[model samples]
Target chain A: MREVFGDFNDGRSAAAHQVAVRLDTNGLNITSEGAGVLQHWPYADLRAIDPPHADAPLRLTSRANPDARLRLGDPAFVEELRRKAPHLFLRGLAQPNVRRNAGIIILTLLVLGLALWQGVPRLSAPLARLIPMQWEQEFGLAFRDRLLAGARTCQSVAGTAALSQLSERLTASLARPPPLTVVVADRATVNAFALPGGHIVILQGLLDKAQSADEVAAVLAHEIGHVRHRHPTQMAIRVAGIGLFADLLTGDGSALAELAGQVGGMLLLLSYSREMERQADAYGRDLLQKAGLSTAALARFFAHLAAEAPTAGGGKLLGYLSSHPPLEERIAVADKDEAGEPALDAAAWQALQNICD
Target chain B: MRQLRVNLTLMDDDSTPSEASAPLRLEQRGRASELLPVVLLNTLLNIVTLSIYRFWGKTKIRQYLWRQTHFMAEPLEYTGTGGELFKGFLVVFFLILLPLAIVGNVANIYLDPENPASLFFPVILYMTIGFLIGFAIYRARRYRLSRTVWRGIRGGMRGSASQYALRSLLFWVSNAITLGWTYPWMQFTLFKRLMTETTFGNRSFQFDGSLKPLYGAFAKFWFGSLFGMLAVALLIWGITFADTAVSTRPDFPFSIAQIAFLLAPLILWIGMAWYKAREINLLASGTTFEGLSFRMDATAWNLVSLIFVNGLITILTLGFGRPFAQLRVFRYVCDRLSITGEVDVAAIQQSSTAVPSMGEGLADAFDLGAV
Candidate 1:
């Protein structure tokens, strides 16, 4: 019989007792120096509290006396224990259920990724449409008022008449024109925005940059296209949906979750907006042709922008041309001049130019 | 590693030399080299799994650290599993965060930012988050305690987590209202609450620490910070004056105020660390359990250096050397801490507190798990 010397704590005291352990078919026999046989721990009930490591002592605890502990540092004892009971060594990746767990985790990730990518955008558009038109209009009006609170708004009577004339002419051929609220603001940035619920903002800079009234009318037509498609409301819904889904999956508003939501939201919105811009361009051209305005005005304006600076209208959060499809591509489709009348009379055009004076 | 055996009465005499009844010491047997492979593997797995494997990775690390820590010549054991942590996360995600997020988003859509009434929902949201964070800290501590076992007897914490969270929220509000003067009292009260409820086996710990010992250090910290801010403001004013009055120090490329601005955070951190060391020492010396009284010998310089070096190691290695930094902390604490008084181990029985089925969900989400 091979006897192994070790330390035992019987759970009764803090004292450590030196004992001699002998391995047998039944179990381990522990004997104190003066005391006779102390306890018998069956092999089946034995468990290693600390996973066996080369540098760490093998600490053992048994089910019979759960509070009792045994520490065996001898290499031979470890070898004997391993040979007798190899099941105690299974840990971490070596566990039998590792493959099953990995499979479950992979499956979960795929489902989550697919849902975020395909589910959110598809759902948000329909959800946006479901919101009552009255509520949407109220929201858009409040949002627009707050947005333009600091900017000076130009309300010249002659300019207003000219603008109304141009707007009526552009929408005259539509089966049912939208309830548009157009405002010209005094700002030095060349941009126009189509806000939710048919709110259109024309910057003074855009009027200054346009070579003719036809160019200004072309931009207005594009914004009207956006209003027709209800793009602004859909975009707001998309942002909210992505945020909610990211919170659902990642939880905690953690950095990782926030990053995933932001990057995913930006990429999705960019592509969706690019597609919306293309649609608006096509719709705007059709509107111009139907209204007898020059269809090639918008293309010329885009070419002029491209020639001036590729990033002329770039600024944080409100970049007009940055997120749009390349100007060259847009210009390609609208560059051809079809024989058409002027969008406004010469006097009306001059009045419109001074709209933001 | 040397232990001195003496009668329990020896600790009563303050006049007697500390060497007469040497306190018990903790030992750290783990090495960074031993943990390097495991941490590296876990980090790699975390990236591959989109951090889904982090719960398991944390469990593995805790198991190793627990086993390496030796008290009374026996190693501690960790019984927590990764599945419990994952379940906890899923529960919090679905039941709490998801619903709150949806409501907040919906409210944002409907609410007008220009309207004063719209602030109500946002205020509610912030308050709820604050309360949840407090709740998370208490529960996380409870979970850790329940999983920590020594000599087959589990360490446990007793007390209602909700009450603790309420107290935490109250302290935060009080701190803000008092301009942070109530901070020392809050720390002492909270630490006392935590320590008094902590148990090793069936023997509950007692904390007699008061706010008195903390005020002296806190006063110095407060005054020092005030002066630092005043100095910074003066320097800024000087820089602004110099900018207006041209040709003053034109040879010098950078303003003195700019340099002070850059160094302010570092100096402030050092000062905070100094006060923190004092706080830790006072708190530790006030705790006792089963006739065992503890003491910590943490010094300002040691703590500051430890923090600086650990930060450097983690940052320079791109976080791959996190285990090494953790090891340094464990070693530092073990080397400085000591215990006195005789332990009646026979009296301590297995703890009866029920182990929490789930793990640190909110803590993980909040990134407050500093382990």
Candidate 2:
């Protein structure tokens, strides 16, 4: 009989016993000197505890004797067992369901990619529309307060009247305008942005830079367009959607999830959507035309901005134009030469310009 | 010479070994070559499955490492499955993390930043996360122990994870208030707590060590950090005022001091390695189970070289060589550790502590434990 020397742990104790194991067609015959077959482990009941390797032994246990372990150090025995019980070696990616597993994995990845690329944008607009306008306004006000915590709000009486007058002129053309509040912030940056809930902030430096009242009216019209379309609400929904998607992808709250959120936030902020910008520009132009104001001033303001500083769209100094549609594309939209009334009188314009003082 | 055959059921009747048995040393039987192929395959599968396969991959690696580790002439066994880990992660993701995320998002939108009352939200958030980390460490250790088997009897741990978390949180607060001077005491307390709860089958592990031995190494590390910070401040001062002060006198030794200041971190790291080696030795020597006590012979130079090489391997391979790095750590520990006295094999019965149905979800989420 062909026999192999091995060590056996009986599971009841931590002691190891040297034993001789003879392999037969039915099972393994474990025996010691002067002892007839102590136990028999059928080939069908045998399982490898560790995968077979070149250096280590093939550690096996029987289903019938769960805790008892037999380690065979002989290479020939492991090679022979491999031939008899091929099912033990089929593990990990080499299993019979490997193809199905791989297919399912690939399909899942494809679905996830598609959902992120198309589902978020498609779902966000309707989702944003479903939110109550009152709640959005409240949330937006709170957000604005948080964002502009230390900044001074510009509040000259005549300047406030002139600003609301210009905003009303643009909003009056709409069938149902949002509750717009056109406030001036006493900040030195040439920037203006519309917050969620109909809040438009025009900075003092923009008034200082504008040569005439028409330029200020043009900027106000642009902001009113953003509010009317509820672009900020849609943007918030999309950003939140991306964040949720990232959280799901990272399993639980991890550093990677936070990183993904930050990256997605930066990308959304830096780009701000060219298509959305175009919609706002087109709406602003239509508003200008309906209000009987000349679009020519907007083009002139952009031209002067381009000529004075070619680096306007690239730095923080020109925060108003940074990440805006290319100057030429915007200028082309507002380059019409229609004759119209000035946005405000000379007296109101001077008062508006000195609002920060 | 006649061989004696012992039946599996006969040893359950309490035939204990003598307390004065010879000392035994643990041996590592794994080869780096054997581990590499599995790790490489796992990395590829992780990419293919977007890391969803990592649970299985980690289980496979643990299985291999456990099977190759030898104690008292028999290899250890790991019986954990990938499905358990996956289910655990899913439960934590849906139950714990989702609600917290919703609360956080809502709080950010509504809470006024300038209000002192709103500070409660952030403090609560950090506290919850810190507590969860402590809870995860305990549960993770418990899970690993329950899966580790020797001669068919599994290891286990008893004690409340919540209690551990609360104690750890208290220690963290103490550490901050004391400017990290209480770190050695914190480590000793935590380790003692963990060891007191550890069990192998029916036998319990005990940690009997003093706090005085740890203070010497900790003092060296603490003073080294203080001096490193001082050097950094001096270097910054040199850069800011050197133009005016040193330019007037061309023969100043400020340049030499500048170089020394730049090299302070390297010196500190070397000193830290020495302290780490001493700490490990002390901790290992203090652990006892039944009649067996452990001793580890670790040196600062060997530890430093091992860390340097392991770091190099991990970085050079872009983390694919992590299994190899872990293999080196296991081999180093096994080679250095010596066990005195033998376990009374027959005296130990199978552990009856209920095993966790799932695995270490929070640990996976927090990226805790190397192997």
Candidate 3:
């Protein structure tokens, strides 16, 4: 009988027993040098949980008696067992590390492929939405800060009030409105974006080009649609999930915060998928219809954006439009026959236009 | 105008044989056939998992590399696990990273964007990251050392990571302030610190390299860099002269002057390789583990061709051939490094130093470990 050093596990929760372990033709038999009883583990009932690392300890538990275990102090005994009964010692469990057998490789590929392709895609959206509202709010505010950092804010009191009235009017009609903060930036980029939570940023250039309050309201409604559906939050979740996966892969913890902090920038830069854009558009139409508003205003804004898309020479404009391309298909969808009240009266429209004053 | 290749220590080995006829003997026992499947499987897994399998992938590679590389015909063993690494990463992500992100974002929201004070946020973030990276490298080195086992005796490293980080910070600051002149000093000291801290069972490694001999090489490269800049300027002038004047001549397409001018960058590359090779050689020669002398015989041309050819193949294959590249570098290092004197394995007992609970989390976070 070849002797090996190991720790024996009794049925009770006692201190580990230093024991002399021997593997015979019958099974792995253990004699406790300092403990109360001797145990015999048959090979059929013995199951080994191999150490994840090469130099770590190996644990063997009994299927016959769950509490029975033999913790190998030195894993060299395992190699000896593999040599003795090549079928019994299974840390190679099957093929050793990862390369000796083709079956193990195929199994691993199947499992990981399933986890990534189906798992990530099926889970990213719902998982993202599951994040608490408070976290999403904080996430949105941070992104907004990063976006408007070093840029001038539109601070005209009357124009601000006029803009607030329009936003409140549009959001109040919805069944559930996410907490929204709409601000006009004093930059000349014809764009508007919705951040996670309920933050929206509108460039002064968008305001400057608006022919009427309806056009501006159409743009605002579209942005509000994004917020209402928690698209930004979902987007943030996807990014965070990807960030988490990447960090896990690399074992880098610092990027956790960095990626979290970039949610706002990602929102600004990563264009929503075509399906998401369509969904947002559909949401916008319903919102406008419910608010006694017209889709014609949205169509007109798209028309103007389509025209400006040709002259997309401006650096900021390129950034804005590249992220939110004004598709001809989307413009056509907005050209619905539905009509209702004008977005604002003449004085309110004038005030809204001068919001960046 | 800057090219950044991953900078990593070329691993050295001590074979299992004691009696040596060559004073020092080095050998590589890794078969390309044995490693090819591992690399291919890892590559496949990475693609399927969107690279999430990389931790495990890297672990497998290390395990193979360690097992195949014999010192005196006895292969070293790597004791690290992918699970340990993954757990460490998850802990850092949850405990340190996520909370920090939330706080940072909230803080940025309150900061005045128009104020110059806000610029400090990014600078502070970058600096903090740098510091963390230094700390991470220290810890990762400790983990790697602690996991290295030869003939049942484990190699270990123990020192304060923050102290290492501080020393590294000082070196980096000095390097910056001196316009890169302090690099050799910084590298030597840093390497010395690492070696001095390293322990194998009961023995300790010593790095006795001085900064003086290294300066000649550093100065040579520094002055060579200046000359390279001047040559580049002249080359541009020549190119412009050729563009304007040489087009008129149909028969003189191949001029000796232009050909020599075009080779200036190659000359600079050669100088850079020479400087690097010299520093590495000096470092290897200066290091001793338990009274054993180390040998390194690498040349500028050897490194230049290896890196250049490896790079060309990697780029051409679009990274599919990375396993071969990795294998080639390992073969190169194994072939070039040798050790004198014999290790008494029977004298060294197994160290009871409990393995570190985690692996290279912060290093992974900082992206400090190239491999």
All DockQ scores = 0.17, 0.23, 0.11
Residue A315's lDDT within candidate 2 is 50
lDDT of 1 by residue, A1-357 (tens): 798777676764344555788888878888765567888898878887777887667888788987678888888778888777675677876755566667766886797777667776677668777978878788888888888888988888899899999999999999899879888998888989998888999998898889988998899999999888888898887776666555545443334435655776687778778888888888888899899988888878877875688555333443443578766666677656574788888999888879877
- lDDT, candidate 1, at A256: 48
Count of steric clashes across candidates, in order: 0, 0, 11
Model 1 off-target regions past 4 Å? Answer: A1-51, A58-77, A80-94, A138-151, A170-177, A188-190, A208-218, A243-265, A278-304, A307-322, A326-342, B1-23, B98-126, B220-247, B252-272, B313-324
Ranking by lDDT: 1, 2, 3
Q: Tens digit of lDDT per residue, candidate 3, span B97-185?
A: 77767667656765667888788887776666667778889889888877775544567876678988888887887888899888898
| Reproduced native contacts, each prediction | 0.19, 0.26, 0.08
Real A-B contacts recovered, model 1: 0.19
Judged by DockQ cut-offs, the docking class of candidate 3 is incorrect
Error of 3 at A193 (Å): 5.1
Give lDDT tens digits, candidate 1, residues B153-260. 778789888888888888888899988888889899999999998888778899988688799998898788778877887766776776755425577676665677
- Report how far off residue A10 is in candidate 3 (Å): 28
Q: Highest DockQ, which number? A: 2
Clashes of 2: 0
Of the two candidates 1 and 3, the one with more favorable TM-score, higher being better, is 1
Highest TM-score against the true fold, candidate: 1
